[model samples]
Target: MAADSTRPVRIAGASGSVSDRRHAVSMFAANCGDDKVDVIVGDWMSEANMTARGVMKIEASSNISTSKSGDTFAFGDAGAAYEPTFIEAIEPALSDIEKHGIKVAVNAGASDTEKLAKVMTDLIKSKSLSLKVAWVSGDEVFPAVQKAHAEKRSKFENVSTGAVLDNWEFTPIYAQAYLGGLGIAAAFAKGADIVVCGRVSDASPVIGAAVWWHGWSRDQIAELANAFVAGHLIECSNYVCGGNFTGFKSLESKGWHDIGYPIAEISRAGQVVITKSKSGGGEVSTQTCSSQLLYEIQGPWYFNSDVTAVLDGLWFEQLGTDRVALRGVRGELPPPTTKVGLTARGGYQAEVHWFLTGLDIQDKARMLEAQIRHALRDWSDKFTKFEFTLNGTAGENASNQNAATVDFRVFVQAREEKDIAAARFLRPNIDGMMQGYPGSTIHLDVRQGFPKPIYEYYVTLLPQADVQHKVHLWDGQEIEISPPPQTKTYPAQQPSEPEATGVASTDFGQTVKGPLGWIVHARSGDKGSNANVGFWVRHRDEWEWLRSLLSVKTIQRLLEDEYRGKKIDRFELPNMYAVHFLLHDHLDRGVSCSSSYDFLGKNVAEYLRSKHVDLPLKFLNRGKL
Candidate 1:
């Protein structure tokens, strides 16, 4: 290997969330890889995380930690700073982070980069660490939003659906625009040891680190796209290293609990090598990389605030142990518009749960529902929603009493606080415990039946010219930025699935019906109101079988019970040998406001695995039955 003027920049993602910082540090401590990481990036701010932070900022100074006993929340200055969890998590490893001149880049600043900078600088000073901390701001566009609404009475439209703001039932309390890597790169160029920002795109830290190392410009479209692809690959940290992998069977259970985060070795010429720490326990295979490549992505053009990356013609190869090289990504000029995430109070929701054990569980649920409706008839109209779901069930069998149990979930959403009170939703169930279900029982968590504030999200787009991506240098110098010059034209194309490769007679064999997971692996996540699920097989020969079996109708049939009220779109990634489906509005109103059991849609794939599917005996057993 030849070394250019700029060495291969090694950028490693440490934590996907500030909350992950503590465990991430533990993972890092466990992996004592000799190679020094040039830059470490941490993404603590996510769209859902931002929404929760906004609501907490409105409700209280801090958020309550679920890891501890009831009701105690983490508090700081009311609106002055972000959650200090990241700061605290990194304190124990301050020495390690500054070792070998390893600089840190993170978007854990949440809503206030200024305050985060101050808090971090104070901590650094108190620790007497020789590290300079700089920050980037201007992701906040709430003032602009207010101005646009007040002055023009303009209705901000959804970027995906073009739905106007007036259609929303709630107004936003916080709005943040997506930022690019220029500010981060600028800060790093200015001799800063740590670069912090608020609401920067998740991959921006990696992009910035690469840009600073390579001295690349915004116009370096292809090069920046390479860095962008590398950043996107490792942005979720452990995802590239067998974490939540579809091909988990390929990797044994060893060291899985202590999965290592990913490290990207990128070249100035746009080559990428993804690997993990030698000491950490996890496999970095082509399958893992493929799985992550399609995670939460929609369509072909991989859009980031920095560049529009072309996923076509990309290649993945395993160079050596725990290393995979990704190359051949093309790119174009950045999009004219950037996404802005806004959050509002959606009102309140209350929930309660009951266990209907033994025989006639379904009948018991029906009776309980009928009685509740009759009792709350006069006041039932006040609620925005009233829902009941049979959580889990007992199969037909002769077994222990526990095997004969099923849970009934009673959920309600109301506009007025009084409409969803305990008296209205929770107590009404208590009245039925004796007279309704024969074997009714209560859960240990008595506090579940209560009202809680719900937050809603409204995502839209703003022209790049309207927002400023600026850097705040350590020495108090500010640099304003403009988008790169437009240089290419992207023709709109309709999305269509690959032509099905009809199965052959030789491929036919005895058929068996069982869980999909018996032969394939799956991963599910959320993209706002949409639920994204990707399924793949470990063997290349299984690709056709998997792809052919997972048509739009098949996926709909599998997820029909969970469908929220929209059509499902299926797309095939022949390169990755995977099938991806996006179920619109399946998450109800998205993370914060969703009344769905799986708001994040993280469990959608696992649920699909439970659905029985026909499997060719040759594919399942590689044998003639």
Candidate 2:
């Protein structure tokens, strides 16, 4: 088929993560409204997910003991090292996909693209469908990384901490570099009906589908940028359709049990209108779109393996019910290097929780902590880290027992399993329970008291030229994809001051103090050891106040419990009426090994929203958020 530049390409997002809804593909394929879906893209790779999958592959490899070669993994075996959830999600939708001739693309291959492709092919053959399956490779670079480290070719410094691999205590067992979408585009062009990929960027599937549908060249930066933004928006499926929106309370009446996935009708000129199936639940309003836009992002420059999307001027306009138009997205060439995640064995960790009920909550917690510390004093030096955390406060004037109780958690991590074994770690906490404060009792669940393995995820960048990006067609033909001819080098750190949207000074007469959430909404998530929280206002007039009030210092003060002394970066997205902050090294290590209560940082925004702050009476008079 020749390219149709005039017709818009409709891409439906089926899955966001490895554990996303299993029925998403079937729902999108059968119920995507009047405009049929041309391509269905699922994003299954993340920093933590990659780390877990890498560990699985390294453990499964027999060559790990002999050649010291990280390359010889057991990826050829069926059901080895790939996300099985993807297979489950796609099998039920195959009939609809075959009926509608809908194309499928997903980064579900994890550490093994070839095996995933084989599984898909076998499934299609079993169903007697004519669909062709292709897989993109070159993401697994463990052997190459080890060689580079030994030869001192690259420092592989931690992108977050700037510490070189030389200082790393754990051995590098696995590594996978993020690949671009050009390989996917090639597979699609070569007549592939389904594309399986390893660690391509999350948005690469959508980008590749758009590039193939519209016949876009590499020089088409503006259009590619729009596709990149569209991919980012819908890549998380229901996320843009109100899954994690701050205004979720407003959607309760409509129901959230079966929230709809998103579909992007991207035009050849790079315009996009996001919508969802009429039969599914959830709203696709501007607020929902804005929430997804701010998620897991770093400042105004959103980098992907494909292209750099400049989101400062981006705006979302609600076209109607379940329809939001995204515009003003500009593009720049991709960065010279792409992110590579290296996984290693960090150690073992365990935690035990004790409930302190009724009077003298603080005193009870202090007493319990002192007792546990004294009990573990002899073996404390064997542990690498130890911390005591008090969660919640006892209510005043009494309520029920559960309502009047607080929890004290004792967490510890060690380099060796025996250091945190039952005798050394769990027993001390249990021994102190009888000698503890009044009404002291541990949680019924004892599973967490046992030490579990921890995998530390280290992120660094690798030059695009070093990756051997390739696509394998259904017929066994392999196509090599070259790096983008035009590329730009971004600064190691974001600019101290992003170009502000320059709002005119205005002052309302009186001010009232209340929770910031009274007039503002927020969304937040983790990126490695860092967390990004973006705050936005529902009303346009509140933009100036929001941007003015939320400085790095103010955020530190608001989130003082966890982010007080942390280095923070602030940026503005004036068009969205949002101010974003990136708190550095907030999550101890990444998700796999973090000991923070809010391990994924999903509650960072909610925590900030709960804090009281002075708000303009004019905005509060209009309505509370």
Candidate 3:
């Protein structure tokens, strides 16, 4: 391989390994293979990643030993426990780069720029590396800009000022504000060897580099958009190069112990070529690259670098190992309005579900609503906000063979636990026949599970003045940032299991644990558990064979034994071999209700695993079961 200095240079992007940081840095070092690149990007954090950055900071901060699933109290102001292990692997490469005068830039933290900055400032100052400071967090800002657009009376008003003055009261769980790449590009242009920043929109890193290197302008929106897309593909670090491709087969055969990080070889014109380090995990297929092009994108008008992209003529094909060619992506002039970021105060919320059954399903649904309001009467004074929603309406509509069995959801925000707890006690209301309703049904389950904080999402645009970049440096200089003191909290104890109230039965003896597995199919007239189970299965012949064995009798027997007395109506689709069962009312002595059609239905495959049956069960709606 030959090295070229005249053309826009390429960089290696890698990070995000469960092991040590050295693994990620080393993976990229080996792939660069004598070629000197411009930058290095490390990615951590998911799209809605809620992991507290405070936990990944300062060396003194201790990680809470308790698991996050059961505890929600991990919010400490102290920086998080992040060991920059990847930076270790990059040591040799950094040393080599210093020899050749090539620069490097790595993220301070993947999620929170504010937090990453605190930690990164410490590292650069302590290590004495000639690393420049740059902060990138446009993805976090975009949604705020979107909300401002919707809330403010006019776009011309200083919407960002409104949001900031209001203390950014409308923040989402995850914010990916599309940022212009100019600052990042300027950092590179200024001869920074290593730049540290936070949450730089994936595309911005590359777009910034492109503009910085080529001196492109906002008027070159399409060109900028193309660069943004190319950058975006490589931004996820490995997805575009096949890290998460569902179509990936023969992964072991691909010899990907050290998976490659993607690199986009872009031109001054709006053309791009996708490639990865020679030694990377996964493939660089056109399919894989295209998947990244549209990831989580709501529409074609993807924003970045102050431009909107019009991706009409995207085309790509494999180009040997670890390489895929891309062309035909077009972009148009962007809208005049700029996007902004905001975080607002949020209200408490509760989600409640109730099962409704019997003929005249629509009328039954109406009656169910009335009963819900009546049940809430005692606690009505405590709730400041309340909303009754019919979740999974499409699934409910499809499940009504004779009559609809509905799950109605009610959400409320209240001052005290009992105000919310009122709904939990009301779970037993529909176990049997009601005063005005015919036939009996179980109330099934209530979302009595503890209520967690929920936030509303809003997006708006702020005038350019409202948003500005601030960079702080630390040369072992102590900054006065008082991270919340780290405190350890014990996990809550689990409740003892309730003693069995009745004898258990194992009557429907035989078990065929093929695709259906050892699923406890619910009975008919059950509006909750008897819902559809959906999964993807290739190879039609195998599916048809599985379909042939799942007899109505087999399904009926499963229901009979599971529910003891209720009957079920089985519906099958051999093409997909997906099954939907409409279940009968419960037989739990009118005390416990079985919701056969609730939520997304049961984990039939997982249940079979619990029974020590190893066969896989494919459902129609739920993901792989």
Candidate 4:
């Protein structure tokens, strides 16, 4: 029998990333109430994760070349090709899943879907559970990308830098297209109990599960858009339930030991109410939802493989404790292209750190840099890039020794391992300690100085028609999924800066200069080499003031010197009382190869919040943040 479409579909998010708590599946399965969970979705892949898996696959193949049998390397070997952690996460929950008749969807098949699917099927059999498993594939498109580039059909341009791949110096190894949810929906429609995927979009599983439960057709654009937003909100599991919320102080009393995962009660009318299990920790309020909504998004228009969500007018209401109703989301046809990530072997990198203590920290750093430079001058040209940075400043008149000490770092990258070897990189620094400035000492651990392999990540768009989306059922039946009939082409350039509105006047009476965090909350994340930071105020009165204060020029001025020259795009979300900035080429060559201290860009929001800005005395009178 089909599910009743009138009732809302309950979707639970179990895992946010590869490292998220492993027991989330069991927790969600065991905590169901009168309104049970219909489906569980887990997002377990990222750009860095793909690169690491690709490298592992390549290394495993290399090792197989010298084997006795002389057989080709097999991707079926789950250890090197897929995320084995998913098995652990779901193993204990099998009984609950079977008892409750719940469906499971996950993108844990990092590089190999069929293998993981087989493993899951065998596990189900071992438990004597009558569950059917399926897998989705064809996300890998390295050969197709190369062919397209060679035929001049596409340039495979870097989305962040606008650089053509023709001039790329690294050797390409892996490419995967972001697929839509229709494939997962197809598997579920065929009675699949568990669906595994490789490179589907992070939110695709939610959209797929919703589509399956509601029996939605391809033309249901508005409902699909709502599902897309719901997916994004809970895709990070605990994120929407105070995991990364700025109001974490409030959750400390509730206990952070078992922070809850998020659930979306999505209705056929496109309405969504976000909540969590009764037994879990953490609170769900409008502010927490706002934080998750503002995270990792580039602009007012949030693009997904299934639908393009117009988030400009999106708003939320707190109905009760741990329940927020999302509203006002609009929809459009998905963009003509879907994002694709390509990984390449960039080379090797190494770093070493030294402690600078007490007075003359600046002079001590300068002396150490000069000494290292002079020592390595003869071989400096061998390195592709070299950098010296003095991280943080010692506190003035410090009471503790740690407070009076700062770190000096030296980082280098090169084409060959020998160029960044410890003998060449760390020996000079060690020898200079005797003649170095007073109180100068290298870090106790020397492992960081050793060269390690790194992979460069590039993101671009591929036409939907180019992707070979398909689903493999447990019974060996294969289903091919076609591209959507409707898609709109959006301008490649960022949208024009939005004009400030709703402000009665620039003047807010009296003012006090203080950190922006005093009245604003923020969240930031990375997309390839680009980073997005979004700021939102709690009260409606602060909306106009925030819009007037955070212009593009002001943001550029506040950014670090290295990021000042990079291009930036700013957009507004009026309903959320928020402004967002997208910093391009901000993380070097993305997380796998970036040398930045904040490589993942998670701390960019906190850094921005720390910047001093004039605040309205009236708003400050309400209370300190």
Highest TM-score among the candidates is held by which one? 4
How high a TM-score does candidate 3 get? Answer: 0.52
Ranking by TM-score: 4, 2, 1, 3
TM-score of each: 0.90, 0.94, 0.52, 0.95
Indicate whether candidate 1 or candidate 3 has the larger TM-score.
1
- Across 40-67, the per-residue lDDT of candidate 1 in tens digits comes to 7888776556776666555554454321
Per-residue error at 564 for model 2, in Å? Answer: 4.5
lDDT of 2 at 134: 94
lDDT of 4 by residue, 1-625 (tens): 2456789989999998887888889887876555478899998787767777766666676773221211112222334477778888999999888888889999888887788899998999999999899999979888888888889999888999998888788878889889999999999899888999988998999999999889898889899999999999999988899988877877888868779888899998778999986767997889989999888588888888789998889989999989999998999999878999888877788788999988998898889999999988888899988999999889999999999899999999988878777778888878899899998799979867877777888889888888888999987799999888899988887674844656667987799999898888999988888888889998877988999998878887677575658888888888888898888888777788888898888888888888888999999998877
1-625: candidate 2 lDDT, tens digit per residue: 3346689998999899876878888877776445578899998766656766677777768433212212222222232578777888889999888887788899889887798899899999999998999999999888778777778889998877778988988887888888878888899899899999988888888899999998889989888888888888899988998898878888887778778888999898888899986666889988998888888687878887778998889889989989899977899999988889889878788899998888888888888888998999998998888999999988887658778888888999998878888899888788777777898799869768877777888888888877889999989899999988889999878854533346565575589889988888899988888888888997677888888778877887898767647678888888888888888777788888888888888889999998988888888888776
Global Cα lDDT for candidate 3: 0.46
Could you tell me which residue pairs clash in candidate 4? none
| lDDT of each candidate versus the true structure | 0.74, 0.83, 0.46, 0.85
Model 2 alpha-carbon drift over 4 Å, by segment: 1-5, 32-35, 63-79, 498-503
Question: Candidate 3, 104: how far from true, in Å?
Answer: 4.6
- Candidate 3: Cα lDDT at 533: 26
* Each candidate structure's count of clashing pairs: 0, 0, 76, 0
The better-scoring model by lDDT among 2 and 4 is 4
Error of 1 at 351 (Å): 0.9
